[model samples]
Target: MKHSICSFVICLLVCTGSLASAQQANPKYDKKLADSLKADAYGMKMYYLVILKTGANTTENKTTTDSLFKGHMQNIGQLAKQGKLVVAGPMKKNDKNYRGIFILNSASMEEAAALLNTDPAIRHKLLDVEIYGWYGSAALPMYLPYHEKVEKNQ
Candidate 1:
């Protein structure tokens, strides 16, 4: 009798837990926002992921290197404003020779390559790059606006 009573209690608790989880799983879906972001059923989309690496250019000319990097930052800002570059940032010191990364909202590898060529640092070989097709959240582009607000210097 005791074993049967324990089994019944365990079954009741399991059913109650399932009911609570099902209730919390139902969230309000925003179809308009999803459509605007071009999100799939899983709220994801395709993008170009560019990994920046240390280039072979070890020129000692600080002025030339500075100019190239200045142009690089300018190009990054321009692309972000145009909604082409979704995310970009540098990496901490590492052994793998990685320099930085860029997530580009480009339709094809050719388009992404063309965009990278616009950066003087990349064009001059101060920074080499490897690009791959990436599947990520469609709302990744929306973070730029929030980033701007949080940036105190800009």
Candidate 2:
């Protein structure tokens, strides 16, 4: 029993030492960019993760639905342009009825909720949202510009 315990302790120590030595620093770290993105020491910051679920109301006619969804897309673009929304996309068919997700750059849940309310789909109950505080890379928005270059569709 004593021999096994000592072996386990030594193995744990070795792994811990290896991890410490393997840790690498970011050579490209930019203080100005970090400050602008409000990044912490680990290059992460807080944002809101919004889960768009199937709402209770699903009775809208096709024409109405089309208009609302179009408005919804417009609202998403507007929010992204305003820098209030960092990410947004729809999900595939699923059992949970999750419709889409949005990563919002808001100071508070209230602010996030208010931003969501602007969406025509959410406003009309075509979609409902579940908001959660999320910690993620502060550089998330930095990829948006690159996405434009790669996206084949306009």
Maximum-lDDT candidate? 2
Scanning candidate 2 in windows of ten residues, the lowest lDDT window is 139-148
lDDT for each residue of candidate 2 in 1-154, tens digit (9 for 90 to 100): 9999999999999999999888788899999999999999899999999999998878999999999999999999899889899899999999999999999998899999999999999999999899999999999998888877998986
CA lDDT, candidate 1, residue 89: 96
Best by TM-score: 2
**How would you encode candidate 1's per-residue C-alpha lDDT over 66-88 as one tens digit per residue?**
99999999999999999999999
TM-score of each: 0.79, 0.81
The Cα error of candidate 1 at residue 141, in Å, is 0.7
Question: Which runs of model 2 end up more than 4 angstroms from their true locations?
Answer: 1-26
Q: After superposition, which runs of candidate 1 have C-alpha atoms over 4 Å from their true positions?
A: 1-27
